[model samples]
Target: DKKGKYTVLSEKLTSEPMGIGFKKGDKELEESVQKALDDMQKDGTLSKLSIKWFGTDEYKK
Candidate 1:
């Protein structure tokens, strides 16, 4: 509170992106994952899943 009075505060949370970590020599797995993601996006599955999980389709980025 400012001046001993009630005050409303608002702020945006900063965070980093999280992803799956893999061991060395996992190029094939990485490529597969990329392909799967691409397919999902092309087929609208990704957006549907995002809406289902996040309550909004904010995964286009």
Candidate 2:
């Protein structure tokens, strides 16, 4: 289910979410980032970027 060079070998043992960090109360920054992410998902840019960077979008599972 992956296009990367590595093998899965076994089922995923843990979950690790990734994202940007900001100051404790940066609502403006949060809003802007959330908007960009939404726009990308809406336009299919997120899928393309995910494939390019992670080699597969099956991680969406």
Name the top TM-score candidate: 2
4-56 in candidate 2: lDDT tens per residue?
97865445455687779989899999999999998888888888887776666
Q: Which parts of model 2 are misplaced by more than 4 Å?
A: 1-15, 58-61
The CA lDDT at 42 in model 2 is: 82
Over 6-61, each residue of candidate 1 has an lDDT whose tens digit, in order, gives 74334324446658776788999988998998899988898999777656665677
Sequence-dependent TM-score of model 1: 0.64
Query: What is residue 18's positional error in candidate 2, in angstroms?
Result: 0.6
Deviation from truth (RMSD, Å), model 1: 8.3
| Segments in model 1 whose C-alpha atoms lie over 4 Å from true places | 1-15
